[model samples]
Target: MGRWGPRLITLGVVIALVYPTLGDPPRDGFPLSTYPMFAVDRGPVTRVTTAVGRDADSDRVLLSPHLLAGTDEPIMAVRTARTAVSDGRSAEWCREVADRVARGPARVDGVETIEVVTETHEAAATLTSDAPPVSVALHATCPVSRR
Candidate 1:
């Protein structure tokens, strides 16, 4: 049984890793997740959330994962993009993200310009607030593509 035991364990591990990928839409978890940062809820509390775009009138415009990154991972992309921008490579990251946004099928419409900002909110408090955002840090901007 010793000889077969090791091989059986190896086969089981492989199956577990591949199982999530075998789904119709390819779910992620356990040993096959791309990354599982927020696999579970963190509970209600004050938190800072990063936002992707602002309109020409300087109004907040919501962005989806696919629109910002062409992937179902805005959090990961936001972290990477912020790092790139903060490291004095804003031009490069801006162009890359802008291109990805432009090529996305569900791109935000009617926005002539785009900027990344961070907003802080308290989850326990009421959603309505007359006060300004706790902070508004602009990280990058790109002109909307005419295409």
Candidate 2:
């Protein structure tokens, strides 16, 4: 191999590594990542669809991803909730969550009802400062049947 052989190989490797960065964020996926942390502009506020439990006093307890979608993956749970709301099946989803709360562990101890909702919030603010959502869209609500 000549001096140019190593140089050519290095150039080829560099090009290969950088090629995926050229694609748009949504398309920059598959075997290679688009690195949405750096590429996607999440903006200031984000709308998240989720399930929550409310006791008789109206205190809200954010349900876990498992209770929401029967999976521990948050993204999957979010997708499940979003799909249910868009498909006009939020009541069914709410009932599903309510049943989970009634039968699952004691974290949701006094929860009396389940609600499927979408809330618009500034990133991390709703959690860090305990800030309320800028807006809330209630998709469905149902009672928790304690057996």
Candidate 3:
């Protein structure tokens, strides 16, 4: 019975961990989870996020997606960049991004500098060039690694 008790507890823990995978809402904290960040609906409002570079005159220059390490997951990519900016590691992140881009297939010979910008737009807003961004915030900027 003593040996059986430990095995039963182990089985119970396994079952609890796998229960969420069976249609339950993903969650984190107490026990463990897959960090259900997007488990709930976020509604129609969405913010378009991107990273770009600016010339010496501050003119915006669209950077290649390679800046995000060419990740297949856009949300994860943006979150990582934003976290880096918020954590005050934007300079290191910028260097890593620039290095990745230079080594990527985008043919960006070099990146002089970069910044992470986020623009909020209503999902139903007219997708026109002149619609104007509802809001634009500059998160971080850093000079790219020349190396």
Reference-based TM-score of each model: 0.54, 0.73, 0.57
Better of 1 and 2 by lDDT: 2
| Prediction 2 global C-alpha lDDT | 0.87
Preferred candidate (lDDT higher): 1 or 3: 3
Clashes of each: 0, 0, 0
Instruction: State candidate 3's TM-score.
Output: 0.57
Ordered list by TM-score, greatest first: 2, 3, 1
Q: What are the per-residue Cα lDDT tens digits for candidate 1 across 1-147?
A: 789999999999989877776777667676576354566686754444343655567776666766655578967767765676567776566666566656654546655566755555555453765545555667667776756
Clashes (candidate 2): 0
Using lDDT, rank the candidates from best to worst.
2, 3, 1
The 10 consecutive residues of candidate 2 with the worst lDDT sum are 24-33
Model 2 TM-score (2 dp): 0.73
Cα-based lDDT at residue 27, candidate 1:
77
Point out the worst 10-residue segment of candidate 3 by lDDT. 102-111
Question: For model 2, what is the alpha-carbon lDDT of residue 76?
Answer: 96
Q: After superposition, how far is residue 135 of candidate 3 from its true place, in Å?
A: 1.6
- How accurate locally, in lDDT, is each candidate? 0.63, 0.87, 0.67
Candidate 3 RMSD computed on C-alpha atoms after optimal superposition onto the true structure: 5.8
Candidate 1 wrong stretches, greater than 4 Å: 2-51, 105-107, 126-132
